[model samples]
Target: MDDVVRRTALPGRSQSPHDKLARGLGYFSIALGVAEMVAPKAICKAAGVEGIENVVRGYGAREIATGAAILTSHNPEPWIWTRVAGDLADIATIATGLRQDNNSKGRSALTLAALAAVTIVDLACANGLNSEKASRKTAARDYSGRSGFPQGLQAARGAARDFKVPDDMRTPELLRPWT
Candidate 1:
């Protein structure tokens, strides 16, 4: 998106300690993303996906939200809250698109879902449910396991890297997918 739109769409890019903290996560995101891009085999093994890594690398808010639903509906962790928040935001965004007059219902739904993902993340962090660092780290760790989802963590990391997600977006402290 254009700078103006990106700046306008979300919260201000203030340089407070909080913003700095979020940027700090970017390193983690980058590492994961890089690992996924560079070494899918090792990452998949670490995370447990003979084929799961490719599927996970394709994740967006919708996928994360679905995972959250499964977690909440069945097996939840304290860390699951982070995914929940992200999912909610994705839903909210989809809702927003549905409300717009000119947008296609389908297109709006997708956009709304994406928006919801980011917004849920914003809410979660803002509400003290989780700090950005803790939340992202938890997400990285939980998602990194190869058993359930293989390449996803790596994919997320790669996405962050491709987008040049700031440090806050990376979350590098989490263990790497491969050694």
Candidate 2:
């Protein structure tokens, strides 16, 4: 199924803004995961939390897995949604740090704010992917004559066949809408 998705191309379909953002999120996740894994002590220190390097590393692993999944999947909605869940978990962890005696309250607050910003992006991407998927499904159905496009396949084929071209438009590339 994954191979099929990677191989198939939807004609005349451009990448939506949501798709771009989701891809960006995938990259961001990878970068963050690397940081968490390679510099857990620094991350903990900056977040004003102490003695949680192992926990930070575990979160890093989760981030890397989700990020890789998001990057590879043709339909990234589920993986993006998983990132949202992870964001919530991160926020919870930071909140706990705020209550700890050794933690810096100000730093914890700032971390929470940053996580909130990330959560917003995660949610927007997730919703966008969901809507995009739905529209694709609808388009597929219409193309297959299951719904929409009243005359369906026959009408489509006829339209294509009947379409006239100028004498100067000799190339197939010029005839294709996607071009």
Candidate 3:
């Protein structure tokens, strides 16, 4: 015989799923960009896209910019969309390696596949961000009518006029004269 399992509701989340994904992707972008900048030739060899060292370095710079922007922006949706565009650009550039002249079609294909996957993630994150933004816009409340005080202004003023401190509370014995 097996014991019954108990189920519980999940606690509140500090970040939305899209935000978490975006943060992870931002870090990944910076790391990959650094690798591309530091060793463009190695990256090209791995992807089977040779003779584009300068282009790879430029892409690396672009990646770093987008990643930094995403991490620092107050509203990251636009930055995430920027990453999606970057992915498309990368996919387009890598597809060139599929040419008949390039012998490493397998590696290029693999690279393209990976880019496609990343692009999908970016698209999802961007769409989620947009949804969140739309919901926020619709959910805004008007707090302008609120007065911080619980009582109305006139009442508060009247109470203050009649205010009196209790004897014990007015001065603690500890801070009194030592006589």
Candidate 4:
């Protein structure tokens, strides 16, 4: 996008396809995390990955945290980047399973492909968010001629010197420190 168009007023940049994508991905992460955490054994069996329930659960926790941050933050850019980082970690972990001797090699490959797809989406979303610009221009007004006090500084300083405290606002006699 051109710099001029990017630097538009607030409403113009409020909603975009990238924002919706980010939100969708957030919900997807939470759902996937829940399933992974709740049924690690089932996931492992389905994914053909065995004996890694604990690792799966840990990744699930990471996913949930990343998703929550993405959903709750005013700016989800950093959270999305976190997701990208997590994706890389997941890819690395799954790649180890791609060894020829691994019984679940086929499933692992499939999972890696899916992860790659999601990572692409994450990268695109992160890039979109990074490029988004805010062009809100503050109005320039001259306040130099005005003073908070109507009188000059010296007179204003003592203007409230004789002011009396209202009974309602004063400390109770019982709690007073001095007679």
Ranked by TM-score, the better of candidates 1 and 4 is 4
lDDT of each: 0.42, 0.82, 0.80, 0.78
Model 4, CA-based lDDT: 0.78
| TM-scores for every candidate against the unseen true structure | 0.28, 0.70, 0.71, 0.66
Per-candidate clashes come to: 29, 0, 0, 0
lDDT (C-alpha) at residue 75 in model 2: 77
Which candidate achieves the best lDDT against the true structure? 2
Better of 2 and 3 by lDDT: 2
> What C-alpha lDDT does candidate 3 achieve relative to the native structure?
0.80
Compose the digit string of candidate 4's lDDT tens values, residues 1-179. 34333333343234667777888889988998998899998887766677889999999999998899888875677999999999999888777777647678889889889999999999999988777633223212334545677675666776677998867566776787774
Candidate 2, 71-98: lDDT as tens digits: 8886789999999999999998888888
